[model samples]
Target chain A: MIPFRFSYHKPSSLSEAFEILSEDGAVPMLGGTDLVVKMRAKRVTPKVVVDLKFIDELHNVSFSEDEGLVIGAAVTMNELIEDFAVVKERFPVFYQAIKKVGAYQTRNRATVAGNIANSSPAADSVPPLLTYNAKVKVVSADGERLVELKDFFTGPGRNVLKPGEIIHSIIVPYESPSIGMYYKISRIKAVDLSTIGVALTIIDPDGKRDIRVALASVAPTPVRAFKAEDYIRDKELSASSVERFAELVQESTSPITDARGSKEYRWEMAKVLPKRILRELGLFEGVA
Target chain B: MTITLNVNGKNVQVDVQPNETLLDVLRNKLYITGPKEGCGNGECGACTILYNGKVVNSCLVLALEADGAEILTIEGLTKDGRLHPIQEAFIEENAFQCGFCTPGFVISTKALLDRNPNPSNEDIIEALAGNLCRCTGYQTILKAVKRAAEKLGVEK
Candidate 1:
């Protein structure tokens, strides 16, 4: 049980949630898989806990060719996997990453928005979302705005969200003929944070091998390997060039030694995993 | 806060604090001890229960959020006084050692069987990944799940 006293409010509408969140010490809770644990540990003590799952607008998951994919803030990982086949067919990397978030019971309550909102560097969903170039739809009592997923995180456990502002949904632009995967090294097979995560997507539309690489657990936040992407743009992914690309990807990281892994080990894997993963994804050509 | 919950097919009203977890209410207030508290956080699945027909950790769920929702714990698995088929299979297979994590494993297995009915070994592994057995008696537990599946009329 939590060691503090807090009032709970379940708002039926966004306006109500905004009104409650505008007050001092009022916090919006999506799934509470992370927040409730923090509260129990006394890391976060709020006077009012506003539950946002009751809002009808936050339960939407709609996709279209024009609008791409729009997943609401309250959509759980299980709902995304079971109810929507499009996610697996179109965004396999995102689907696989979501499956690796915690375990089955936690996934039943965990939301993608909550995962992003937590702003953890080891969050499984961020690397895949970053590779997909997802956008965060932020809503406030005054209005709403869209922020790029790459620029969303400010630091560890920090984001651009202001008071009274909540994420409405995540928007993923539709890309065709693209296949990608998220490979993570965790302490165990499941239920542990990723020691290092790499998401690689090769968009080969009209033979343009536009490879996008994003990584987690190597920095303060999940980041895209822009230098590597620039180096490998439209070039044939040969063994030597892929090795160089892997080195550039490793150059982009500024990791620290923690309990999960050493900084040197992360730097090494940051270089090694990309090539192996590239080969595993069948993007590498002519021997590793 | 006063909330009404349909627990084990019975509608009951209880007063709970907003900060209190559903696991605390089930084990402390209502005295339903089926869901154990191995870890206060969700790392261990000792408090697994069916919330609105989906398996979730009760410790992570607020008691207030569970208001008016249907809940099923391990106690609900028994009919009259007879043990559930899953429970019988567990005993027959000696699926547990110390038995602290039995309730959660049973609930997770039931959730899996209810949905899949004939689950593959991969399916069972995925479903029970949240639950951890300190006794390390997973082989027999797996056998029990398969045995329960057999008893439910699905061949292996």
Candidate 2:
């Protein structure tokens, strides 16, 4: 667990952090849960670690009618799980994915921005956030811009974030007129990547309407199961639809086998999970 | 660099090197030997501590980043020479074999029970997942958690 020597800078304000990020070879650290591990692995040895703990704007979770939910970049996974609004309304799948992130201890320190910024292909939060159509706000020396969450990740452990640009917050639209949930099947319940993760949000309009299903760990990035979703729209939910959608979801993802689980296992579970989630959400009656 | 951490209810300010972790600052400088270093990459929970009342991997956290934050170690579990309910439960349940992991477990359990007094079996397992015990005394550890819950009388 050896990392190269580096300069430490604790910036209390957003402008100070922007100045640091504008410098060459600088990395903005929120919680250091991901950054330190990568540093020890010698994967990313930046010359300076700009700690953003003092930045008040990057450390809050607030609600707004105009913008939806504004989640600070430094908000930990534990905070998301314990947030009353998140647990009750906006999204329950986010909590389900968060619970499997690690142990309770690590979650307390692992920030949501770090989880997304680390850009792991199997990050539990991304898929569900993608399902919700979340937006990321990136701040730099020049200014800030919002990017769609689905377009945030470019590849495994990578994103399109420009040099000297730091993610300040994520904006999730509170369009939760549906029952949304996430399910992941891992080797074990804790500290492991998902073999396949499924997120479903069914918006029932007077028992006759539209639904959306998004899934992850099935492709290079979290993908929306548009084909399967189109199959269930405006149709009465039932066991037959669940089976059909399950079959359709298997065709949606491109899962690979690593140490976590087999590609076949993931493909198989990818089919099973969506239908199970729909059932649990009461969209598909008598299918649990 | 000088860093001030409110450790164990005491405001102790100390200076450390650029490449020092919270674990290094605690054990080496402040002489707060409660947080032991196991796997310094945040996998093992040997260096667990309560930062702002939430359990975190102290080894991964830089000392400079923890300035002005309230930290609680196993030593802080007792007040006026009275053991915390979780600590008493451990003693009553005989929850240790070699005891190297006791302090970390005690602090971790305190964080869990404080937030959720009547955590379910799954909750307990989830809370302790980061901690590892070579003695395999998880049964007694679970018993201690149950005992603490009973002593508190807050079931969920």
Candidate 3:
């Protein structure tokens, strides 16, 4: 059980939530899968927990061809997967990423916004979101702003969310025809943290090939391999070019040795997984 | 804070501290010990419960968050004191050894069969991934789920 006593506030609106969160020890909570665990471990001791699930606007999942998809903060991974077929069709990488988080039970309560806010380097959703070029809508008492998802993280367990500011929704803009995959290496088949995660999306619009690559648990935070993407943008699909791309992707990561995996193993998989994913997608014309 | 929960088809009101978890309230306050506390950190599914018709680890949910929510524990699976088909199937198929993890597995199986009356092996494996059983090697448990599906299918 949580070791401390704290006031609980369920705000019906963002304004009320902001009003209560303006206080010193107020932290916004949704799903509480991560927050409550932290509270029990004494990692965070807030005086008040502003429940964001009560806000109606935060329960929305609207999609349009023009605006893409806007997922409210309260939307759980299971809810998204069950309710929308468009997410699976349009963002398969994101679908795989969400499906790989925790297990069936935890996904029923774990929210995408919470997943992003918790800001774990090994978070399954962040790499896919990075590949999608998602944006976070940050709402505060003063005003609101949209931050690029790539720029939102400062470090492990840290983000750009300031006091009294809460994430409103995640916006994934519409993309052209693309095929994406999220490949994760974990110790177990289910309910395990990713030892190494790689998300790759190849978008072809008007005969132009655009490759996007992002990885998790390989650095201080989930990051996109911009240099690798640039190198493979116009390169032919050959054994040597794919190997060169993998090398660049490996260079972009600075993994640490931990119980999950050694730094050397993470580096090796960082190179291997991307190539494996590319081959599986039939994007590589190289040997197995 | 005083919160009213619809537990096992009965609306009950109880006072709970904000720090108390749903698992704690269910086992300690309400005397509902069906959901066991194994790992307490959610790694083990021994404390699994159906929260608003969805299977979730009760240890991870705050009591306040479950306010006004519908909860179904293993105790709720019986009707007229007769065991649920899933539970009966477990006994018939010898699905458990110590029976410690049986409640959680039974609850998860109920959830899965509720959604899909006919489930394949992959479906059963996916649904029960959160629940771990060191005994029986899961082969008997898998048979129990299939048998439960057949029983429920006939009843339906």
Tens digit of per-residue lDDT, candidate 2, span B117-154:
88999888888988877785599999998898888774
Listed in order, the DockQ scores are 0.88, 0.67, 0.80
Q: Kindly report which residue stretches of model 3 are placed more than 4 angstroms away from their true locations once superposed.
A: A285-288
- Looking at model 1, residue A29 earns an lDDT score of 95
Q: Tens-digit lDDT track for model 1 on B40-130?
A: 8898899999999999999999999999999999999899999999999999999999999999999999999999888988999999999
**Each model's C-alpha lDDT?**
0.91, 0.80, 0.91
Q: Write the per-residue lDDT of candidate 2 for residues A80-163, one digit (tens) a residue.
A: 668645444656666677777867777888877888888887888877777667899998888889999888888777897998
Q: Over the stretch A82-117, how does candidate 3's per-residue lDDT look in tens digits? A: 999888888888999998988889899999999999
| CAPRI-style quality class for the chain A–B interface of candidate 1 | high
Model 1 CA deviation exceeding 4 Å by range: A285-288, B154-156
The root-mean-square deviation over C-alpha atoms between each candidate and the true structure, in angstroms, is 1.5, 2.7, 1.2
| lDDT of candidate 1 over A12-113, digit per residue (tens) | 999889899988899999999999999999999999999999999899999887798899999999998899998988888899899898889999999999
Quote model 3's TM-score.
Answer: 0.98
Candidate 3 chain A weakest lDDT stretch, 10 residues: A202-211
Rank candidates, DockQ, best first: 1, 3, 2
